[model samples]
Target: MIQKLKDKGINVIAIEGNHDRLFDFEDLSWLDHLKRENLLILLRPSVRDGKIFFDEWDGERGGMIKMGNLRFYGIGYQGVNNSEYVERLGELLDPSFENVVIVHSAIGGSSMGLMPGFSKIEEFIPLSKKCEYVAAGHAHEKKIYEIEGTKIFIPGAPEYWDLSENGEKGFFIYDTEDKTYTFIESKKRKKIERKIMLQNGSEGEFSAAFSMAVDENPVEKDSIYSITIEVPYGVFCNVNLAGVEQKLEELGALKGRVVTKWIGQDSNLPDSSDDLDIERQIISADPSLGNYAPEISKAIDKLKDLHRSGDTDQSSMVIDDLLDQIIGEDGI
Candidate 1:
C-alpha cells in the first residue's frame, strides 16, 4: 500500500504503535521496502520506568507537517502523556493557517478511561476551533464529534480488533480546498456486540442464556462478535468458565468468530454480601472485577469466613482453602 501511494507521488507517513514493533522484528522485509521508498515511519520508543517519552525526530514528538493548504501535527498517544503531547502540539500550531491534528490513540471512555478532572477533551476544544479538523485512530469504532466548530474524527481502524464488531472500519479523506471530511469505508469484516442476560439461576439456565444470546444475535460466518454475559449474583455457582469457552468455540465453528467472551455481574445485585451468604455469592460483583485482585480477595475472604463458620454443606471448603492460599501468595 505504501509503495502504491508513493508511486502516485503521495507522501505516506506511517506511525508505529507498541504492537507494531512485534511484527516489525518478525517480518521486516516490508518495512525495508518502505524505508527504501523514503516513507516516513515514526517508531515509538519502549516504555521505561513507567514512562514513554517521545523525541522530536520521532515524528516531531510534537511537530508540524504542511500538506497543500492544511498543516497536520501528529500526536502519538495522548493518554500516555496525559495530553501533554497534545498541549505541546497546540503550542507549535500556526494559528493563522487551517490545520488538522492526527492521533494514533483513542480518546474518550474506551482507551484512557474517563478523563474527569483533567479536562483533556476541553484542551482540544479551543484547538478544534483553530484547526479545520482532527483525525485520530486507535479506536476501532468510527465516530465524528463536532465541538466548538471543530470536527474530531475517529476514523477507527481499517482492520477489525477487539470489541469493534459494531464499529465502522474506514479511512477519512479531508479535502483541504473545501475543508470537508468524508469517510471511506473499508472492505474489512463487520462485527457485532451480543450481550446475554443470565438471571439468578442454575448452570443450565446460564447455558440457556448463552444459547439464547447467540440465537438472537446470529452472526455471519465471517463476522466477529463480543459476547458479554451479565450473570446475576449466585447464578453462576455451578457455571464453568472452561466449559463456557468450549461452548463458545463450538458456537464459533457454527457462527462467525467469537473474538472475546466477557462475563459481567448484573447491576441489580447487591454491592456486597453483608446480608446474604458471601460463600454462595459470585466472586465478582461487577463487570470490572474480571481481573481486579482486591475484589477477588474480598470474595476469597468471604468464602474463608463461610468455611470457618461451617457453611460447607453446599459450598466447597477445599476451593476456599485453595483461594486463600492463592490470594495469600499473591498478597491480593
Candidate 2:
C-alpha cells in the first residue's frame, strides 16, 4: 500500500504504534524495513539517558521529517511512558518551519479507561504552546481538542476495531497555513450492533424481536454485525444462539456474532455456567480489549471460584496473571 502511494508521488510519513512495534524480526522491524526501502518515512525519536532527542532525516534517525515548509516531529509508542521525553517536544522542533507533532499515545483531557502506557493530554501542554498542530493515536475515538494555539487531531481507527466503536471511519487533511481541517471518509467496512430484549426466551419471542430489529435497521450488505439477545438467566437455554447467528450469516453479513446478555441474574451463579454479560461489559468498558474479553472473563471466573474457596493467595495470583495479560509483563 505504501508502494502504491509512493508510486503516485505521495509520501507516507508514519510512526510505529504498539502493534507495529511487535512486528520485529532479528533487530529490524517491518517499519524499519519499509523505511530502508524508502517506501515510507518512519519517524521515531531517540531516548538517551531518559532524555529525548531527534535526529535529522539525512542522519537516518527518523525523529523529524521536513516536507516543503512543514516540519513533523514524531514520538511513537516508545514515548508513551516517558513524561520527560514528551514534555521536551517543543525544544526539539525548529522555530522557522510550521511544526506538527505526532505520537501514538492516549492524549485526551481524562484517562481513557485507565489503560496502561497512555500519556494524558496535559503532558502535551508545553509542546502545545509551541507546536502548530498535534496528531495523536492509541485512542480509537475521533475528536479534536485545542490547547493553547495547538489543535490536537485524533482521526480514529480507519476501520472498526471493536463492536463498541461507531460512526464514520476517516482521515483528516489539515491546512497548516489556514489552520483548517477537512475530513475524508474512508471506504471502510461498517459495524452494526443490534439488541433484542426478550420478555420470554421462547423461539417465538426471539423471532419477533429479531425480525423487528432487522426491519427497523436492516443489516447492510457485507458489513460486520452483532446481534445481542438479552434474556433472563434461567430462560437463556431456550434461545438457540447458534441458529440466531446462522440466520444473520444467511442474511448477507460479512461476519456476525450473537452475544447473550443474561439479565435478572444473581451474582452467585455457578462457575460452570457462562456469564457472557461480564465479557460484554468488559468490551463495552474498553473496546480495545477486542477478543481478549473471553480470556479475561475466564480469569474472572477463576478468581470468583478462588474467592469462594477462601484462597486469598490463589486469588491474588490469578489477579496478577490477569493484569499481566492485559497490561503486558510491564505492570503500570
Candidate 3:
C-alpha cells in the first residue's frame, strides 16, 4: 500500500499509534529499508528547543522539512495530551517558514459530528498561529473544523479498528502545490451492523434466523458484519457461535464480532461497566477531579499496586507452607 500511495505521488509521513511501540528504533536505522525504496519520509524529530529527545513528542518533536514548496513540522504521538504545552507553543514553533503541523494526537474541540470514544476539543487552538494546518489522527472519525482561521483536520483511521468506529473510512490527500487537501473515500471494505432478537428459539432456529439476517444484510466479498442479538440464556447456550461465524465466512464476511445480550434475565440490568455512572457522578461532584478528570483517570489506571495485586505467587507460597508442615512431621 505504501508503494501504491507513492505511485500516485502521495507522500505519507507516518507516526506510531497507541497500539504501536514505535520507540524501539531510536537509531532510525531500521527504517532505512523503507527509506531506501523512497516510499516513506518519516518526520521523527530528534530535538526541541535545543534539547534532544527520544521518540515523537506531544508538544514539540520539532523538525522542519520542505515538501513540494510547503514546509512541515511534526509532533508525533507521545500518548498524552500534555495540554499545558500549548502555552509554550509560540516559543517552540518556528514562524520563519510557512509550514503545516503534523500531529498524531486528537486535537479535541468542536463537538459537531464527534464520533464515539473520541477526545473532545482541547488546547490545540494556539497551534494554528504557528502553522497553516494541524493535521491530526488517533480519532477514528473524520472531522475537520476551522478554528481561529486554522484548519483542525483529523483524518481518522479508515479501517474501523473497533466496533464503535463504524464511521466512513478514508484518508486526506494534501495537495501541497495548491495548499489544499481532500478526503478520498476508500471502499475496499464495507461495515455492516445488525440488531436481531430471536426470542424463544432453538439452536437450529437461532442459526436459521442468523443466516437469514446475514443473507438480508448483503455484505460484500470481504467486509465486516457485526450483529448484536438479544436472546434467552438457554438459546445462547445451545447456539454454536463458531458455526455461525463460519457460516458468515462462507457467505463472504471477512471479519466480525457477535455481541449477545441477555434480555429475559433482567431487562433493567445496567449496561457496560456498572460503576461507570457512579464514577462519572463522583467526577462531576468534585471540582478538583472535574477540572482534571482526564489526567486523574490516566493516573488511576497507571497505579502499580493495582497491577501487582493479581501477581501473587500462590503456588510458591503453598509449597513453602507444605515444606514447613513436612519439616515438623519428620520427627514422627
Candidate 4:
C-alpha cells in the first residue's frame, strides 16, 4: 500500500513509540523495508549512555532536518537527555528554521499505558512555548489544537491496536508551504459499545428491548462490540446474557461481550459472612461445585486446599475419607 502511495509521488515521515522497541529491538527487518519505501523514520542518533536502543534504525535525531522545502527541529524518544526531556529539547532548539518541533513523547496530557505520565505534560509546555507548531507521538488517541498559544498535534496510532477503544483511527497531513494541517481518518475495523439502562422491564420484555436497542444502533460486519445491559436483581436469574450475545453475533458482530449489572441485593439469600460455612466458600469461588451435594463439595474443597498449600500428609487422609464417602465400601 505504501509503495502505491510512493508511486503517486508521496512520501512519509514518522516517529517510533515504546511498542516498536518493547522486546529487544533486535528483530527489525520491517524498519529496513520502510526506509526503502520512501519513508523517513526519525529517532535520536545517540543516547547519553552511548548505547543503541534499536539495532537497525539509522535516522536523524535531535536537530534540524529539511525534507524538500520544509524544515523541522526534532528529537527522538532515545535522544531525550534529562528527566525534563521536553523542557531540555525546548532549551536546546534554535527555533529559527520553520519554527516547528517534533518528538516521540506524548503531548496531549496524561494517558494510560504507553503514553507519558501527567507530570510530563508540564515539561511539554516549554517546547510548546519555543515553537509555533509542535507535533508529538506516543499517544494512542489523536488530538490537535493550540495549548498556551502553541499549535499542538498528536496523530495517534495509524491502526487500532485495541479493539476495546471506541475512537476513530487516523493520521495528519501537514502543508508546510501554507503552515496548515488536516486530519485524514482511516477506514479500518472498529469497536462499538452499546450501554442500555434496564430500569423497568419484565423478563419477557427484556428480549424485545435488547433487540430494539441493537436495531437502533446496528453492529457492522467484522466489527467488535460490547453490549452492556444494567438490570435489576429481580430479573437477573431469568435473563440469558449468553443468548443475547449469540444473537448479536448472528446479526454481524465478529466478536462481542454481553454483560449485565445487577442492582441491589437479593433479600432471599444470606448476606452475612459469619452465617456462611467452609462448604459455601468453595461453591462461591467455583460455581461449578454447586451442583454437587454439600458434604461432597466440602470434602473436595478440603482436599484441594490441602494439596495447593503443600499439606500433603493430611490430604491423604482427607482423600481416603472422600473416596469412602463416594464408594460406600463397595468394590464398584
Top of the candidates by lDDT: 2
Query: Per-residue CA lDDT of candidate 3, range 1-332, in tens?
Result: 89898989877665444444335655344343575566666556564576533342233222446655466665555443334333345456665666677766665422222221124454566665667677777666677877667777876676665653555558787765577888887664667888778776467667777768867887667877777777753354456667766766777889866766554423233445232333433455575346444433333332321122221222344345444554554532
Which segments of model 4 are wrong by more than 4 Å? 26-29, 36-39, 49-64, 73-84, 107-119, 158-160, 190-193, 199-206, 215-219, 232-246, 261-332
* Ranked candidates (TM-score, high to low): 2, 3, 4, 1
The clash tally of candidate 1 reads 1
- Report residue 251 deviation for candidate 2 (angstroms): 2.9
lDDT (Cα) of model 3? 0.56
Among all candidates shown, the one with the greatest TM-score: 2
Model 2 lDDT on a 0 to 1 scale: 0.69
Q: Score each candidate by Cα lDDT.
A: 0.54, 0.69, 0.56, 0.56
Q: Please, what are the lDDT tens digits per residue for candidate 1 over residues 1-332? A: 76678789887655543234333253344443554557654433333475543333333332355656666665543334536656655655676887767666554541212321122456565475577777765555688767677777887667755432455778889877776668889987556666656666467777787777778876456555556555544344456655665565555633333322223344444554342324323344445333444445544554543333223331464456556666666665
Sequence-dependent TM-score of model 3: 0.64
Candidate 1 lDDT score relative to the true structure: 0.54
Query: What is the Cα-based lDDT of residue 275 in candidate 1?
Result: 27
lDDT of 4 by residue, 1-332 (tens): 76677788765555444444432553343444576554654443344574323222335333455554445655554322323555555655555545666666554231111112222454566765557577776555677656567776777766665544545558777776686778888876667788776756455677777778888889889777787776654454366777777877888988777776544445344444221243454455555434444556556555543333233345566667666765664434
TM-score for each of the candidates? 0.58, 0.72, 0.64, 0.59
Candidate 2 similarity to native, TM-score: 0.72
